[model samples]
Target: MKVTVFYSSDATKSAAFDVQPSDTVKSVKQKVIALHSPPDWANTALLAEKDSTEYFDNRKRLAQCGVVDGAVLKFTYARNLTLMEKVELNVQGTDTGNFQLPPMSISTLPPKVAAY
Candidate 1:
């Protein structure tokens, strides 16, 4: 079974992996981390269905979690800031006790405009 995984911090960033029904959520997360190579600070990754409140347990198998082939799973990295967020923080000099901005969705972006 093949599943598409998207990073919650950046929906535009996603990866596809060929997984087995018997594969555990932890195994799937390993594959995604290997492929995407997200920041080292990323401690935990949670796999959830898009627009769904339920999340798969790392100890449970894909089949047990009701995951099927061609399913879209959103990967959320909890307890750490994303690479882009880190860069922004550095640029803003947050370490210097300067202004701090609230955490927001990195996936949201303004619509593109075409140039003549």
Candidate 2:
């Protein structure tokens, strides 16, 4: 049986797999990461075609999960946090609304400690 996996947010980020009825969801995720996914495959979730809210168990077999050939499995993974993103998360929330900030790139100019 053939199953297609794609990112829930972006359909363009997807991969197709030819799997057996006995294949586990965990194995499918392995291939998905190997092909062209973020390194965080363990966090990737497999959503069934019928219900977007429900997730397929990794230990369950394709046949047992009601997955069929041509079934579209939407997957979503957590993104890695950058230094600034991590810093923002550590910031405490107050009654004045959340202190939110966008990630940034920094550059500096050379210092003139002893200019004549």
Candidate 3:
């Protein structure tokens, strides 16, 4: 069975994966971490999907969620801020109350820093 994994930093960021049925979310995450090898300070959020809906970590098991063959899985890390974005957000005079950031460009590329 093939499962997909998707993850992002801002809730909107996402990626797809094709993996084995036997792989747990944790296991797949380990593989993804190995494959991506992100930096220590990055924030990564993991998510699983079945059909169109997303999975919550509290109730489901990666394997028992019927992540059968050819399933598309998604994981995301929303809080992983780039240096520029981080600086912008942290500015002392920044109008954080009304601040709105532009939409992030979601990509298939793996994260450079691992946001745990």
Best candidate, TM-score: 1
In terms of TM-score, which candidate is stronger, 1 or 2? 1
Candidate 2 TM-score to native: 0.57
Instruction: Give the per-residue lDDT digits (tens) of candidate 3, residues 1-116.
Output: 55545443445543455665455666666666654555566576555663454554534455676666666666544455565565487685654344445566877888899779
Using lDDT as the measure, name the better of candidate 2 and candidate 3: 2
Q: lDDT scores for all predictions? A: 0.80, 0.69, 0.57
lDDT of 2 by residue, 1-116 (tens): 88888854655776788999899888887787676556443444455653376778889888988888898887766554554655655664323334456644554865558967
Tens-digit lDDT track for model 1 on 1-116?
A: 89999864766888888999999999998887777666667677788887776888899999999899999998876655655666677889765333446566664778678998
Local error of candidate 2 at residue 46 (angstroms)? 4.0
lDDT for 100 in candidate 1 is 49
Poorest stretch of ten by lDDT in candidate 2: 92-101
By summed lDDT, the worst window of 10 consecutive residues in model 3 runs over: 6-15
| Winner by TM-score between candidate 3 and candidate 2 | 2
Which 10 residues in a row give candidate 1 its minimum summed lDDT? Answer: 95-104
The true-versus-predicted C-alpha distance at residue 83 of model 2, in Å, is 22
Provide the lDDT at 30 for model 3: 67
